[model samples]
Target: MAVDIRTQGLQKPVSVAEYLFARLYEIGIRSVHGVPGDFNLVALDFLPKAKLKWVGSVNELNAAYAADGYARTNGIGALITTFGVGELSAMNGIAGSFSEHVPVVHIVGCPSTVSQRNGMLLHHTLGNGDFSVFANMSSQVTCELAKLNKPAEIADQIDNALRECWIRSRPVYLMLPTDMVEKKIEGARLDQPIDLSEPPNDPEREDYVVDVVLRYLHAAKNPVMLVDACAIRHRVLGEVRDLIEKTKLPVFVTPMGKGAIDESSPTYGGVYAGTGSQPGVAERVESSDLVLSIGALKSDFNTTGFSYRTSQLKTIDFHSTHCVVRYSEYPGVTMRGVLRKVTERVDVGKLAKQHEVTKVVNEVAENRDSSDTITQAFFWPRVGEYLKENDIVVTETGTANFGIWETKYPRGVTGVTQILWGSIGWSLPAAQGAALAAKDMGVDRRTILFVGDGSFQLTCQEVAVMIRHNLKITIFLIYNEGFTIERFIHGMEAEYNDISRWQYTEVPTVFGASDKQVRKFIVKTKHELEKLLTDKEFNEAGGLQFVELWMPKEDAPRALRITTEVAARNNAKAE
Candidate 1:
């Protein structure tokens, strides 16, 4: 029943690898991130020939992590890995990207189709002759999975999988056999671009949802607006901001939704996380008569151990694909569509302004001297002073993740963290990818990474990749002795929560960085950090820089401490 693609095409045939990379290049993927393996070597050779830069990473896991960072910044990103071991190693990173709604294409070069048909044992295989195990595992995490079985269907399969990735904002898997990489296929399809546009909204459904939202807004007193992570993921930040401006209501952002809105806005309230929220934020938000929550994700950590006290009956929730007004749910009513309508038609002048809540103030006090020991209380605020406009801030899970919430990000700065998945050691490689993405987009921005010593040890080698590519990245290494977050979660004094110590500042040198090009610092006191932040020459330096700041092992941010206590109690009850 399959129609032959060769019969109707007039153009000359192209290799499947060439065709795939060409399609990726046409669609804005300028670089491919991954490590080389035997199975993928044949396809990797076609990278530069396709006009795509081959960005080699330290490991497949870091490769995938880098690709995720790239995708979020560049709109779409890709990585290539080999069969079995290589692909399996990258699964965790891909899963994180899927959880966070990043668009990434995972192209896996697998064994040749001939070997699979003949049941030949391969070194990377499980020896039982089963080759589909990894792809099956990937299907659970990816939005779509395409295995190139027939040469004629190769182009169609590749194109379809990429389209799904763009539409869903999640990772997709494409498996290419070694022999199939060079198989002849029609090149005429290259002339036609893959449609990446979204389908038009259903007017009736959109109108109904928008009208329902407006009715709730008009009828209630003490109305409040809340923004979450989906506002950024679904590409509706501008619309959300417009709605906030038009309504002129008190607005607050969740921890996951940090940096999506201008925190400097007059109506901007502080972060709202129940008990973990900034002072007076929880009281104002929980007491609201009407809560209009957009792109809300009620994760335990995001909501401070499910601490949101807002009544569901008084809330209207907007999601990426649906709208929920109390108990009634309207499917196919996208938040993007609803926001557009609300921004265009709503008149906020008729709405009354209620008593204003005090703004959450998180400015850091100036350090007295260098001899003063650094603590989480003082360190976060000091780091805030170092931030500049348009900086892409990346934070690792654990202490750095929770600590950064205490620091107010500067205007024009964007924050990236894997809060939902809580993956450790993600920001290091992600910084490399983000820096590269910024460079590719021609955006002059610094990519800053905040990572704990324990987390840095997991994927520290990625710094070498950053250096090799001359990525403009500044790394702040928290030199707390061990796994501080785990200690707060369950075992406060347990030795099992500890990790081995290393010479943190010597990392860049060990990673093949030269002395003149790389700047390294180890600061134990508050004075050193302040001096470094104020140094114009150090701040304007190109290439890589590393700073090791020593803090107490048992110390953590106030929000982290509160959330962990709640988490501990929840865990005890579950057990």
Candidate 2:
């Protein structure tokens, strides 16, 4: 027999950057968002060859945020950065992706493997010559980490990390040394598509959990279903809709869970947030004999300071990785499987008649007094009317997050937020990313963003990127002087809560946007807002449109007031 020495598994040769970008393109990443750095410039050159577009951001942090927003809409997104300095700056955005369970592939181009091994001081690294510090920190927030050192192992490592990112619906990290970017790697693995299939559940455990859930589900006289953010993260919104349609049970969403289900469904009740829940929704959810919570994440903001009154014994929680029927837990049973089984097994038509809660009644009249000024009280309801079907709404963490909770979204309107992570200045870049994704996918949808003045200041530079790309986005800039949300939480009159005033309407011009490219409005009165809303040119604009609405510094949404009061009390105790 002839000695087989054909480099083992290597059937063809391709550069490392070529292989990486090819895999990303195969995984539905039409645009790779990031700022180019010295280390990543060479790799960036391969993007065009791979037939991928490079979305150059103003900075690394915004790049990561953009990637996250894209991932939420596009199913998967990828971002690239330079070594330590770049990666560290992008970590906060990565952590937000991790906390909210958005799948993003964070690729970092680093110093050569030889330099890392020899402990040579690199420009992006700390002067002490420790390059491993940043990677270790990233491991905490990422689901998986891969450092490409050997050519033979690089292809497998890349595939594994990207697979984990898709399967878990969370961010993953990949380090590509500068020298490795051009090195030839085996191309045979590229022929096989990345396996993103969810792991098979043990049949016995799946059957047991589903049966137990059905037993509790069918026995109760009054039952409710709560759909949450994880449902969106896990890409099971259709199955959730099926569960609702099949069971005919009243459905409600958590704060973070908003937009995961069709708000227009006849059985759709309202949002549930303990005391913060819509009228009668809390009573129904807490007092029900059985509550089926699918993909529920009971974070602080989602639960209204842990004020939920639902008894655990009456709850059957279906999580991403497991199912919990009261106190009994099934580890291998997933929400996806349980949802399918429930839709197939449950006899929803024969179940007892349940009271159907009407859709959220808008108390604000369509026609208000023209002389009245715009208030937080009047602003949100009007916004509800402005929303259209299939709009991708992005909200900032501060006032926008809480304020949007009260606004009733139309059917097919999807929501994006970082509520659990509570990061300010997140929505701006996120809007850009989402807009790019929507355009890239040929999906006809408008990207609307609600952000505060203070938060906007943090990442305002991304405005240029949006203008450069000519992305169609509508921005509602809530100008309340400073960090109104923070002041409400603590330091009501402190100087630390204040921010320098800027010409909010002139921001587009300052950021390289022309008058024709961006439609700008400064409205301090309700009449002006209403007129602007009705303007045909403003409504049908093909480019960016901005509205700066002025409100009192002390005013806030009802839910935000409640949450801030509790947070302030907690902070007082610490002091």
Clashes of each: 1, 0
- Candidate 1 lDDT by residue in tens digits, 1-575: 87656644637688899899999998888888998999999999899899899998899999999998898778889999999999999999999999988889999999999999887888989998888989999998999999997987888998999888987888999999999998878888898999987665799989988898888887788989899888777778888888887888899889888888776788888788888887589889998989989888788888889989999899999887788998889987788888889878776765666676578756675433444888887877677778887788998888877877777777878888888988888889988898899988888899989999888999999988988888889898998888888899988788888888898888889888898768998888777777888888778747788988889888899889999998899888943
TM-score of each: 0.96, 0.97
lDDT of 1 at 102: 86
Provide the lDDT at 56 for model 1: 89
RMSD for all candidates, in order, please: 2.6, 2.4
User: Candidate 2: how many backbone clashes?
Assistant: 0
Judging by TM-score against the true structure, name the best candidate: 2
RMSD of 1: 2.6
Please give the lDDT score at residue 427 for candidate 2.
93
lDDT of 2 by residue, 97-150 (tens): 999999999999998888988999778888787888999999999999999988
Poorly placed runs, candidate 2 (over 4 Å)? 1-9, 366-371
